[model samples]
Target: MSIKIQDLPNRAAFDVKSAQDLRTQFAKDPQQGLKAAAQQFETMFLQMVMKSMRDSVPQDGLLNSEQSRFYTGLLDQQMAQNLATSGKGVGFARLIEQQLGRTVTSPGELSAPAEAANTAGNALPLSTSDGRHLQYRTVLNNLPTSASYGAPAAAPAASNGDVPATSKDFVNRVWPHAVEASRSTGIPPQFLVAHSALESGWGKNELRRADGSSSHNLFGIKAGKNWSGQTVEATTTEYVDGKPQQVVERFRAYASYEEGFRDYANLLRGNSRYSDVIGSQDGTEFARRLQQAGYATDPMYADKLSRIINGPTLRQALIG
Candidate 1:
């Protein structure tokens, strides 16, 4: 069967239909399918790169309008598609095709690489001034379901606060505090940073005060009746009977990020609930203990936190 690349739907955006179609094509002709899939990955990567470049430029000029921006986006998408299909894409597609050809034996095995490609496009910047880009060395397996802990549940909603534009910024800002917290709790500094990133969406979704200041509640610790600290009220999602429900709750606030980290360390050290969490060097085990001890209501909390701790996002941010 001759594969018609032009017939693929949602080529520029992530869609379930596109993935299904790719799998079907792979079943018929593995060689051509691998090429097509690689091209698709390159197209997504190029689009993300172009979008990031456009975002960096000022958009407040008089000539910039909503319609113009919309059309410009379309133009970028088409350009990305053309570049990938023209066989001259910055070598990403070629590299992916070669890599897949060596290890991929059946169509069923294509999902891992396909999902990894999608994740890479979403989580990575294509290039920096030094011409460095994020590289995928291997395909990541699907995370295990949260059934071991209890019924499967949705991930928690992100906290409401400002976030840095890049992962590097997030890591740099929190590294010192993470180090201090790690010293007190015996948890790895990167683990603490990853936990904070999961809770606050890499500092983007932290709890904020009425005046739009940060609550500095990096761990999402709530204000209880015995607590006498400042608090910020925010709507948060809690899992009830395996369903998500939103309710307002008061979270502990801090004067600074250091104070927040210090409080977090104290909580882990002072409370008996987190006895297993302290001094745990392994990221996966630490996250698992936190969930098992009712750190958050999200059933997938441990899995989500573990992903950040072990995933490429943190690795890239730390290196960059």
Candidate 2:
């Protein structure tokens, strides 16, 4: 049965104990707890809406008695709760679930955090609950921990293909854009796709904001003087005298893959430094020229991209 207004506790009396109970339930079973919490939040929102609507109704001295007002407020509260409970509440719960819900991969196993998330975990200290960056940490930490008692889980089996299933999906999704880019830049679609995969770790890693949203910077293309857009500051590994060093850099963030690819294609086509890479059908030549043009600070950037372009994944992507 739905909770009634008469049964509701005083708003001020909704104390820490109630919230703690919710958090405890969340820790025990996140899916159900999140659903319940979302409904509660929705209920609170609806109550406010009801109060606003009630206040907007013009008051008549005859019907504006204190008893009428109190009873009417109670009725509105009940109606709000019922509306929220009907599975037609505003989509706030779904948005909350998409951001915080655990992705169950098996009976017990959870997918490892994305590379950007893992980097954030290692680089930033846990923030207070009220802090701006705490949401990501809280969401990630609420997942079943490594120490959580559960059945032994197996890793995902590879698909009936040469590449990882994730890679196949990535290639398939990005190939059409890549083909368009290739037609403009004289680069092969497979090479363009492979280069992006190499840059983004097969779409596992990309730059992220403090709020844990993707920058969608598939090419690791930094924002230079002539560019104007949102940017993210991230720690990148650079090679100096054959030694690796960590450096903080600002990178461009695009709204989507198409923008990122368009920018990447433009960078190669418009710059004289990358002239050696243009019109080069050979993946090795393209990779080497990009490295020579200071596309990245890593000494082995060419070799790494070459390896990716020559891998079975690229072959499969081309065939697909």
Candidate 3:
């Protein structure tokens, strides 16, 4: 049962507390009412999702490509439905604008903030709930003073089917996980890092959730099921064949880096869609196969990944 918003004593200016509130409103509600509610919340959720899409959503300004078709399809059809059903779009957007002190013109404009949401656990410069850019002091405070609970987990280093060097500790820490991700998901390590860096700013983004809590999520991977960690209710994308299909989900969080690293690594290893890359023994071939296998929504996703890997920034992030 969803709790009534009024039942909650003190809520931030634009907070909606219970699924029941949404359910009573939309999970199962009358058509007219749902439409009205969606009108109100549509803008707000768009604000949330736009934060991520601003960067990820291609802006060639023309939707000639299949990727653009899928992207727009999600925005116009899928996301708009959520706004009507949730019934808090205006209020939420208003709150964000108030805190950030800038009006969000379109959902796409929110990419910076969404990307910033990825590295909430580690030190990263970001905006506060009230919308002020600041250091990641909150992250430092959330970490355990001692590793009494468990040992620090380090993912295995990624070998390019050759001798894997360990000179660059920064890249080394994530490469193991990346290599595993590449091997399991067929998403190349550089592609994953570039995406992660774009998503979380190399552990300097998403210091916390909108609710003022530690969200222990890396890669901004949302909670799907069997999640037993901190959570943030937010709108995110659901990709089908690498195309955005628009999904608003509750994301799970972690308390330690080990948990996040392990979960991400395993996510790829376990999912069968990514099984082809498992121990394939070729980097470029792995990338090509992933694309051919329809790993992303875009018909040209493999091409994009190739370009990203071959790009200067991604190459440096990988080898350095």
Candidate 4:
């Protein structure tokens, strides 16, 4: 039940080489349906593996301090540094924590600190007339010195995952791996945020089983019988031709949000159904491709998703 940071297995290395080769192979023919199918198969395989890991790990709902899951920094080092204590980056920490037997603590939390300063208008040279100590809010030190306060502290909107670190108060936490998923997998963070918001109602849905049990899913992704992962029964909406058709199905729950996000990225990146979506990191493009690739059955799914992302509420949460 206890896992030290050093003892946990490192699974961050994404084997994109085979994916690259598969992409090349898909390009050679471009005619065969093999490309799309290959992607889904690989994604399914990955999901199954994560499912296995989730099932194998036992949780008494106690996260040991010494038994922590260390997040490797493939992106930002400071985020990695912060994660060393809180245990995650913008996107990955959530995933890593889930694998280590924890669930996302919060969702839909972010803030903009600069506006307060802008509203203040050159106040006290932001404290200290020398202006020598003026630092960006993203890296504000928590020292007791007068320099740490009254000024808009570094309001990092998102550090890892789709969640930003701009907000000082830790109300909601993200998967942290969402950043890795967005940056490394090129899924675009906003899109991921939009999906998360829509899927689990910002982590306020039936993601859990009424008890504090692991649904193994943060996004409320439905489960197919063939899927080996544990399942949670929930009322879900199925998108059909851009319209949300109602469907109550058994959804696949991730042991952690990070795993869910990672699997979602792999599913898109590896599947040919999402080929129209590949290399297009734009949130809108990503949305369009999701519909085109048949990921969502809703007719207005893309529009709804893109609108939410472009809206002021989500945008405000994203930036500091």
Candidate 5:
């Protein structure tokens, strides 16, 4: 049940080449690569701890001889390796794994459908072999800062008028990414557009920062604890005790509408509570399940979304 130090192996001979290989591997397959790198980091960290402990001991005795010190360093390195391999060292690996795990998207995971892939004019780009040019990368790269607050949004579609000129315009704007999202979740693109329209008040009332710039949070998704991105605080209407109440809530801010749509799709697909809504062909059923799953504070959230799905917006958009 116990590990003997005498039986421990020598320190691993990790070098610059090994480090470069790990970085390359992490870029290719994150789960395996991150786990491997994390283990190595833990081993190094444990070695540092062991070295520190050895250094703190007095050097005035027979044990402080040059040969003894050399043997002690070797022993400490072996002890660190043993502790790391046995899962008894500090949990640096787990922490690194957790942080890096979110960035790993599977190959073809976010690919668009056949229909959307063929559609040209949309901002949502197909993932390349390198994946460095993913459309959503714009969101992470162009994060909102305080100075950028209240600045004009990049897209002018929402700023044209009270309501969009036509539902076709909104559909055209989000359709490609909607298809991409649908390919992942099996929810229809029309339904996703309808949901976004409802959440954004037909593109009239997107969440805005203090200076009145749009947050592009088409889903009205509130910022949660795990949200490490930029946010916008805005007054929102919520149903409390079956009565409407105004409250300022923090919502996730995105660099663009496409980014917001992508996040929305991921939110529903990633969450277990929204399991009933995912892959449901029936828009009505999806709406009802999303509401039932506590997607919105409004008790009539399903009804409102259902109306949007069945309304003239969708009707006209479908006809076009």
Candidate 6:
């Protein structure tokens, strides 16, 4: 019996068995199979866009309830699938099909496109509960390929001398300052260091002044009305409704790294909102409290910070 795209039932968003069946059909008949796979990808992409749009808008109307939201989500998913298969889709399916066709030459290359299709179908909508998965992927993607669970070689120091030559260098350079900040705040020094590393990308991505000097704002503490210090204007990423958007903002500039750490500690110590974060000994609790205290706008901030504190990258660097 010949397997036709129309013969297959419309698969659920995360149906692994259905994905496997699609790949099986692909092996038997590549042309129709490719079209089915592309449609599935387009459906998933459209659903994600719809979910993001829904999340951006407030849903606190009188008629809004969990039951209503659930049914609305179902409607969105069905609509996505229908639009994808209707031949008048957003053209994503056509684009994917065309690209895959051009790249896929041999039977061995089939698995690559098949996996791509399956990944799209298996994608989940962004939510607070799902932030850990996003955090893990972000950490993995950001990790240095040269060093996996080990100390990486030193990069050339920047001409400005603020950037560290390696992760080990970063730890050594900031350890004393972190310890000083830690003593005042009653937070662990490692936690402080990890937080700074997460903020600054281990000092390599520190904000710069107009003269290309380091802003020394490792904590990403923005300039507020009460602040009386040098400032730097730079574009920074802020997450709104779980989506990252870049905006230019003024940030506190420091004369030295130690001053930056000192100001960061003082900010937390002085602000009543950060009371829970001040004395946190556990890395996870510290990060969670910081996020709750409105330290950063990034939705995955806590998870990302906690991962850096507990992950092998920092540990390996510290030992090295």
Give the whole-model CA lDDT for all candidates, comma-separated: 0.66, 0.59, 0.42, 0.43, 0.60, 0.66
User: For residues 1-320, what per-residue lDDT tens digits would candidate 1 score against the true structure?
Assistant: 54476554334432223433544455555566666667766776787699889889998899997557756876786788788877767898788777666644444344465555545542221111211111221221111111000001112223333456667667756665675676677676778889989989888888899999899898899999999999999999999987899999999999998899999999999999998788665567789889998999998999999999879888666544
State TM-scores per candidate. 0.50, 0.48, 0.36, 0.46, 0.50, 0.51
> Would you give me the overall lDDT of model 6?
0.66
Count of clashes, each model:
2, 0, 23, 51, 0, 0
Tens-digit lDDT track for model 2 on 168-213?
A: 5666556546655665776656678888898888776767778877
Lowest lDDT 10-mer window, candidate 1? Answer: 143-152
Sorted by lDDT, highest first, which candidate order results?
6, 1, 5, 2, 4, 3
TM-score of candidate 1 versus the correct structure, residues matched by position: 0.50
Stretches of candidate 1 exceeding 4 Å from the true structure: 1-162
lDDT of 5 at 11: 30
| TM-score of model 6 (CA atoms) | 0.51
Identify the superior model by TM-score, candidate 3 or candidate 6.
6
* Model 6 alpha-carbon drift over 4 Å, by segment: 1-160
Which residue pairs in candidate 2 collide?
Answer: none
Worst 10 residues of 5 by lDDT: 144-153
Q: After superposition on all CA atoms, what RMSD does each candidate show versus the true structure?
A: 18.8, 21.8, 22.2, 21.6, 21.3, 17.3
Which regions in candidate 4 have their CA more than 4 angstroms from the true location? 1-172, 210-216, 239-245
